[model samples]
Structure formats: structure tokens, C-alpha cells
Target: MTPAPGGFTDETFAAFLKGRDEPSWLADRRRSAFGRFKATPLPTLRDEEWRRTDLRALKLDQFAPPAPAEPSEAARAALEPAYRGLDSLYGTGIALVDGHAARSPDPSKLGGAVFVDLASAVQEHGELLKDLLMTEAFRDDADAFAALHAACWTGGALLYVPKGVKVETPLFHLVGLSAEGGADLSHTLVVLEEGAEATLVQETIGLDRGKAPGLHVGGVELILRRGSRLRFVNIQNWDTSTWHLSRERAVVGPDAALQWTVGGLGSRLAKVNQEVALVGRGARAQVNGVMFPTGRQNLTYITRQDHVAPNTTSDLLYKGGLKDRSRLVWRGMIKVEPDAQHTDAYQKNDNLVLDADARADSIPGLEIEANEVRCTHGATAGPVDPEMVFYARSRGVDEATATRLIVEGFFANVYDRISVEPVREALALAVAQKLELGSAPTLASAEAAGV
Candidate 1:
């Protein structure tokens, strides 16, 4: 196998895996993944998917694999509120700090279900993990970052709900980073058996305020069996000094339903690819996302909806607000198979430019091979309307207040559609904070301020 570029190499990966007592099959899989990572080149601006985002300034050699560090009192204290709020709203909570499982759900609450650290899951449910892990959602050859994640992933969570079981309360998973100049590669696997139902909320946060940049490459695989239902929400809030890249995919079985939501509000640079495949007849999926990029952040998102069987359906909507010199890119595609008759799919993306220097790009596409399918896609990018501000000001509203109201209304269409109350409220607050810090004053600013 060829040697890996930068500071990552086969020897480095082998040493990292040593003494872990991992199953031989998993060890071989990692070695194979490392070979793929070595052969795959880092993406460049010339690549079609990477055309809008540039990573020439990044130095991968400077980042080293994460080493377990004692969680600091201050770091734990700072994250207390996040954990408390999640636990209060959701009945189950799991916290991983610095790629270590810091907190997990009790066995009594989990019952026959499996909710534990990845390492433990490997020992307890090796057969299940081996069969589903990295099998479909994330492939070794998907991309350079994905290949690297497959070889270097360390701490993660596994959630498995058995057949006919239904979890009434929601579950929360938190992945946090505190070590500087280190990298955290995590994996999350969620499986719901036939007739099962569950709700999962996941969040990634950076707890350290370090000057040096850190790295986070993560992957998520979701599998739903026949007639299963899953509601998933993911919130990303990494520190400004971190670079985040992730890939997520879900496969829905016959008559299964999935509701997936995502919020992006952190990281210096983030590129995420999220996809869902309706592989069984009558499967359905709904994907929604909201992002707020400020300062010099660069955020790119790619989504795919694949209808593989007849009578499948999918709907997707994404909204973003950009400020300062930040840039946002969204690429979405919907594909219907030749046999997928009566398929229904729709995708839309909207961007709100909050600053003159900010930029937004939206691309939507559809690939259909079936004649009896209905598919539609649309994208829009523009600044907030000044006339709306004027109309609000005419109603005796202050300039700042009017701009805030308009911005809020612009996002309310998406936010109000989120089914989870806590997640919706939290994301709304995040957007408000970004607007307060980065939103440019409207035409009413000068007149209202008596300038």
C-alpha cells in the first residue's frame, strides 16, 4: 500500500490501533481503508463538488491524532448547561468529551436496546456493528475525508433499537472537543428494527478556546427497518478555530419514515454531505436544514435524495443567512430509479445575504429515469428586501428592530416547520445572536439614528 500524505501514515494508524484488542476483521478493515486514503488525493477547486470551496490554505500535517486528556473542571462546568438542558428535555443523554465517553444512558432505561460507546459496542454487538458499520451510508471511496475518517475514527456512539420496540422519550448525544492542535474523528451508527420508533438529537460543540486550529472529521449512518420511524436532529456548534467535515446517509426500509433536521452555526470551515436513500416501497423522508455563517466562516452543504423503489417520496428544504465576508454554498440533487413509479420528490434552497461582502451559491438538480414520477427543484439567493424594512419602519418600528423582525420572519417559515420545540427554539436564538452581531443596518438606520 502507498504511504499516506502529511503526518498520517500506515505506521501511525497501526500504532493508534495497537493494544486496543479490536477484532481482527475490524483491524483488517481499517488497514484497507488506510490504503484507500493513501491513494485518494485531497480535493481541489478543480473538482466539480469542491469548485466553490477552497482548502489550499489548510495544513493537514499540523494536526495530530487526538490523545485522551483529562477533562478540565472549567470545560466541564461550561458544558453543564448544555448537558442539563438536553437531559431535562430528553430522557436520555450521552456526552463524549475529547473523544471519550464521558456520560452514557443507564442500562435500565435502555432495556434491550443498545446505547453505548463504540469500543464497548464492538465487544458486545460486534456482529451487528460489523454488518452495518461503514457498509452503506459511508463508503471508503466516497471521498478523501471519508477515507481518512474510516481509518482514524476513535470515539463515537452506537444506538440500536430492537424490533417492535418504541422509545417514547427523546435521546441526546453530545460530542465535544477540548484539546488544541488535535484531531477528533468520530462515527455515529443508528439502527431501528422493524416496527420500532425513536427520536435522537445530536450536537457537536468545541469547548476549548485555543488559538491553534483543530480538526474534526465525522460520519453518520442511519438504518431503518420495515415500518420503522425515526426523527433525528443534528446541531453543529464547533469552535471558530476548528475545521469540520462530515458525511451522513440513511437507508429507509419498506413503509419506513424518517425526519432529519440539521443546524449549522460554527466552525471556521465546514463541508458536509448528507444523503438519504428510499430503498423500499412506500418509504418516505423529510430533510430540513438551517445555517448561519458570520465572520470569515465558509460553509458548504451537499444533499442527495435517492428513490430506489416504487412509491417512494422525499422532500427537502434548506435556508441559510450569511454575513460579513462569510460564504455559503448548497448543492442538492434528487434521483428516481427506472422502476420507481409514482415517486414524489421536491428540493428547495434559499439564502439571505446579511452583508454586502457576503456571498451565497445555490445549486439544485434532478435525475429521473421513471416516467411516472413527479420531481421539482428550485434555489434562490438574494439580500433581504429594503422595502420590507421600510414598510416595517412606517409602522413605527425602529430600524434595528425592523431588520431583526424581517430577518426573523425570513427564517420563521423554516424554523416553525421544525417539529421539535427545543431544537427550533435553540436554533432561533442562534440565528438571532448572529443577526445582532453581523446584520447590516437598513435604510432606516440613518434616519432612525438622526444621522
Candidate 2:
């Protein structure tokens, strides 16, 4: 068996297996992933996907899996407020502290749903784990962080939705990354069988008092079977001193549909890759994202819409706001295969720059192998329209308030993509909070300053 690499050490893998009571098959898979991990080197700026981000300062060998976290009374009290509205949106809620499950989730309401940690799933659903882990669900060659996640993942959250079952509340999975030179490889897989419908929410937060920088490699997979529909929402709020790397992909089967909405807020440096495939006819997909950056943080987004079947449709829209010296880069592609005769795909990326030093880049392209297909792609990177800013200021708004209004208006389109009111409102609130703390000044904070 191959050993884990980059400070994980063979001993660490063995210890992790023994501690978790992992089955033999699961252990063997982890062992082989280490080999695959060693075969693939860490990604550099030379890599096409990572061309815009700098990695020379990052040393993967410097970090290690953290010891379990034990939150204080105050910490627990702080988390209590975030848990109240979950029941309205999810059937079962799983909370992960550091890299382990902190509380047992009651899956009784979810008849066909299986919600558990990666460690537990390996033991209970060995065959499933062997079949799905690191497969086409996650395309590792696109980025090295994905391969590293496949190899060093110590714990994760896995959600399985059985056929024909509709979940009322979205599944809420909270992953907390504590400091202490700690590293977390958290993975989430959501499978919706034929004719099923569900909504899932994955919330990531980083909290650590240590001065040492941490790392988070997250992978989430969503599979929509024939005639199924899935609405996915991602909320990323990492610590300012952490490095966040994530890849989210979805496979849409015949007559199936997928709607994805995302918000990127807190991170010293973050890279998110979102990919969707129209593998069968009559498949529909909509991808939307909103990002807010401040200080010297950097945000990079890469998206792909792959069409393999006729009559497939996909639309993508992403908006970002950069402030201070923060920067953002967006690269997106739409690929139509020869067999895809009547595919309809659209891609758009828009940026709202709030300051002179802030920067944003957009790369949008389309590859078509079929002449009958209709495809359009465009990208725009510019500051807020001066006329709009002036109009807002003439209505009694200050410069900061005018900029905030423009940025908020820029993201209005993404918010309109969601069909659910409560969910949309929740996401709007989260986006607003991030922008207030990030680029725009908050009303409460501004009033306090005025006082």
C-alpha cells in the first residue's frame, strides 16, 4: 500500500484508520490515493487553472491535521444562533468541528437519506465509498488541490439522497476549520435519484486564534438523476489568514435540472472551481455566484459548461466586487461536442471594482463541434458606472453608500435566479453582510461612527 505524503506520513494514515475503525477496503483506497497523490505534483502558476494565482509562498508540507477541537462555553453559545433556522431548510443537520463530527444528526425524518462523516461512511458503506470516491465526480487533473484532497482527507460529510424522495428543508452541513497549523480535507457528495427533488446548503466557517496559517481543501459533488431537480447553495466564510481551495461539480441526467447559487466572502486567498455537465437530453442548469473581497485578499473563479447531448441548456452568471487592494479573476468555458446538435448555452461574468488598486479579469470562451448549436459567451470587467454613481449620490447617498448600492444592484440578477423566497432571502442577507464587512460600510457601523 502507498503511504500518505506531504507530512501525513505512513504512520499517520495507519493511525487514522485504527482510530476511526475504518474497513479494510476503505483503508486500501486511501493507501492507493496516496500513491496517486505522489504521482501528481502540486500545481504551480504554470498550470492553466492556476495561472492567475500565486503559490510560491504556500508550502503544503508546513501543515498537519489538527488534534480534535473542544469549543468553550462562549464558542458554543456563539454557534447556537446559527442553528436555529436550519430546521426550516434541512431534514438533517450535521455539524463538523475541526475535522470530526461534533454532534450526531438525526436522520429519522430523511427516509432514504444517509448523512454521516467520511470516516463513518467508509465503515458502513464500504462498497459505495469505493465506487464514488475520487471518480469522475471530481476532475483532479484540473487542479492539484483536488488531488491533495483525495489523498489527505482525514474526515468529511457525505449526504446520499435515495430515489423519488423529496427533501423539504435543505441539508445543512457545517464544517469548521480550527487553527493550530491545522489542515482540513472535507468532502461532500449529494446524489439525487430519478424523479427526486432536494435543496442542500453547505456552510464553511474558519475560526482559530493561532497565528499559524491553515489550509482547507474541500470537494462537493452533486448528481442529479433522470427527471430529478436539485437546488444547491454554498456559503464560504473562511478566516482571513487561511487558504481555501474548493471544487464543486454536478452531473445532470436526462430531463434533470440543477440550480447553483454561491457566495464567497472570507479568505486570505481562495480559488473555487464550479463545473456542470449536460450528459443527457433535455437537461437544464443555471449557475450563479457573488463574491466580495477586501484588503489584500485574492479570489479566483473557474467555471465550465460541458454539453454532450442534444437539446441541453445551461446559463452562468457571476458577479464580483473588489475593494482596497483585493483582486479577482474569472475564467469560464462552454464546450459543445459533435453529437450535441441543438445545444443552447450562455456564459457571463461581471465585475464591479470599487477602488483604483482593485483588479478583476474575465476570460469567457466557447468551443463548438456542431454547427446547429446556438452558443453565446461574454465577459466584462469595469468599475461602477460613473453616471449611476452620480445619480445615486444626487439622491442623498454618500460616495460609500452610492458604491454599495451599485454593487448590490450588480448582484441582483444572481439573486433572481433562485425560485424559493425564503432561501433567496437567506442568501441575500448573507451576501449583504459579507459586502458590508467587505467592500461596503454597514448601516450600523456607519451610524456608530457618525455618533
Candidate 3:
């Protein structure tokens, strides 16, 4: 059937699938997902989950599906600085420009792991891809945007770690969009087998502020098998003209552990939903996030920690700084099922307002069906402490400098909680850049100097 006028049609989706020459199963999956997307109406402000975030200004019909394009000199030049000194921080790196694989990782460094483009991996690892892609952690019908993602996702990343293997160095995947009025639909699927351990860093960047608006719909699904461990970091730095929406979920098996970190510093408007499910006994998950929203940006984040089995534990902490007329909304929830008797879950969201016009909404919730579970949540949003600024000013710091120091210290807790040094340092630098504190002393450096 043809798509509605000005909206993406089933025929267009079918043509996209055919152009990719994807596997039959994937084509079928796309068709199914497309049908779901068609059936599911666009989310409106009336929806509970979307009531706080407004999307009426967005014109989805203006954006077309992204196609592979050679990275312009300007795009390449802009991306180079982000990777300037990151070479030593990652053992393998993959770069995607405008939803195409621009640089691939070295096969030798991958060892037994599978690190390849999603389209290529679909052909190489058909059975495994079929079992996990768009089916396990993230469902197609989860939301209208999710179904649209499953149907139109283009170049993406797939990382699979075999059992008993431990990747010492981190793997980095960079996805960038540079076109105007284009849609960047990408998916990232990471599977860690039993007893495996690995760290992955994924960064999304919009290199161009196109004349017309752009759209980015992305999905990430992470699976941790029994006794496995994973540390995943996501950094989003889209340009101010793009509308970003994404869903990320993880499932942890028995005795598994997950450490997830998120950094949100860009995008004109973004709504992200992230969740982690502890599905087996002795599973543990820790989530830490840092966000800095400036200009007129509006960023919304929703997170869930689910305990489905006994003896599972989960902890989450998110910190954000809002400046200019920027606004942020954070909703965090912790759920304990009836069978999760020994569950322990905690969630907190803290926001620092850096300007009078800046606004923040922090909401923390808990759902407990297990009487024996220990579940707690808290949220706070306020300007930087005047007492702290006063104290810093007394020490010869200017007001802006003092506020910057206070803001840095506000986010230092989450950064300290993260285990990877490189990731922490990179995030700190990014945050400093966002705060316009290029030459200012960072919390880490200040602490090192006994300040």
C-alpha cells in the first residue's frame, strides 16, 4: 500500500529494503514493523509519557530517509577534532558519516568478537542477528517512533563478544549526520555471551546545522548473558536544529553486571527512554548520566530499572546543568516485581540551573510489588548553591568562574562513579566545553591539587 501523502509510505519502505538487498527475514521484519508504525499514531501531548514534552513544532513529513553520502570536506574536518586524541583511548573504532560506515575497526583487534556494520553483520551472522535484532530487548511496537526506527534504520553497528573473552580496551563507535532535512535512523545491538566482559562507547553527532530541520531516530539494545559484565557509555551531541528520539534497553542474566553511562549535551529537542531489566538472580545494574543543555534546547530523559528476579540490585544517578533558556525533564522509575523479593533499587536525578531562564523538571518514582524489596527514589532541581558560590568567591574566584566550579563539582559525583578513566575524562572535557570553561580548572584537576 502507498504511504500517506508527504509521509513515508509502505512502498517507499519496501523499496528501501530492496535497495539494501537485505536478508529475507530482515525484509519481512521491516515490513511488519512498517505496518505497526502505520497502525500506531504519532504520539501527542495527551499521552502520559509525552505530556511534558511538546513535539507539535516538529514537521516529520519534511524529513526523508537518510542515504549513504560521501562525507563532505567540512563534515570530515569537523569530525576530526572529536577524535584528535582519542586514538589511544580506544582499541577499536568505527565511524559512520550520514548513516554510512566511514571507518571500520581492525579485524585483528576484534579477536573472536564480531564488530561490523549492521547491514554486513546481517548477512554474516544471520541466525544470531535474527534472534536478537528488533525482537529481544526493544520491541517494534514499543512506540510509534520505535516501530519507525525498526522499519527504516540504515547503517548501524553490531558488537558481539564470545563467551569467556574479556576486551581490555574500550570499543568506540561514532555515528554522525550531516545532511539537511534528512533522517538518521540507526540501531546498535550489543550481545555479550556468558562470562564475557567488555566496554563500549557510542557517540552520536550532528555535524551540520542544516538550513532545514533534521530528524534522528535511533535504538540501542544490549544483552548480557549469564555471568557476563558490560560497561556501556552513550554520548549524544546533535546539532541544535535536529529533533532526536531514541530508546535503549538492556537485559541482564544470572550473575551478570551492567554499568551504563550517558552524556547528553546537544540537540534542539530530545526525548530518550532508557531501561535496564535484571531478569536473573544476582544480577546488578548501575546507571550514571550527565547532561548539559544550553541555548533554547529542550531535553527529556526517561529511565527505568526493573527487578524481575530475586536478589537483583539496581542503582541509578543522573545529574544535569541547564543554561540559557534550556529546559530538562528527567523521569526515573524503579520497579520490583512480586518474585523479586530480595531486590534492591535506588534512583535519583539532580539538576543545576545555570541561568534564571533555564528550567528543569525532575521526577523519580518507584513501583514495588515485593514487600521485602528495598526501593527508594529522590529528585532535586535548583540553582547552584549560593553558599558554595560565596565561598568560592571569597577565595578570589569570579562569579561566573565560581558557578562553573560549582557546576563541575555537581557533576563530579557521577564522573567519579564511572569506572573508565578515559570515558570520564572525555565526558569532563565535553562538559567543560559545553559550560564554556575551556581554561578553568576541572574538578579532577582541582582535587588532584588538593583544592
TM-score of 3: 0.93
What C-alpha RMSD separates each model from the true structure?
Answer: 5.6, 4.3, 3.9
Residue pairs clashing in model 3 are 3-9
Which residue pairs show backbone clashes in model 1?
A: none
Q: How do the residues 1-451 of candidate 2 rate in per-residue lDDT, one tens digit apiece?
A: 0112346556665565565556676556666666666677777889887889887777766664443334444434434444544544456677665676665567776666777877688778878877777675787555456766766676677777778888776667777665432677888887788988877776777654345576788888888889999888787777777788998888899999998887777778988888898998999999988788888989898889999899999999888878889999899999999998899999998888878999998999898999998899888888889999799888899987887777767888887887755555665555565566653222112222333
TM-score of each: 0.93, 0.89, 0.93
Model 2 residue 122 lDDT score: 79
Model 1 stretches with alpha carbons more than 4 Å out: 1-6, 68-78, 438-451
TM-score of 2: 0.89
Q: Per-residue lDDT for 1-451 in model 1, tens only?
A: 0112346765567666774668999988988888888899999999999998888877888664554444566656656666766676677868877667777786676656788878678888999999989997787788888989998787888999999998877788888777432677889999999999988888888765566576888999999999999999987788888899999999999999999998888888999999999999999999999988999999999999999999999999999998899999999999998999999999999999988999999999999999999999999989889999899899999889997887788889888778877777767767877788642211112112222
**Local lDDT at 49 for model 2:** 79
Full-model lDDT for every candidate: 0.83, 0.74, 0.82
Ranking by TM-score: 1, 3, 2
The TM-score of predicted model 1 comes to: 0.93
Candidate with the greatest lDDT versus the true structure: 1
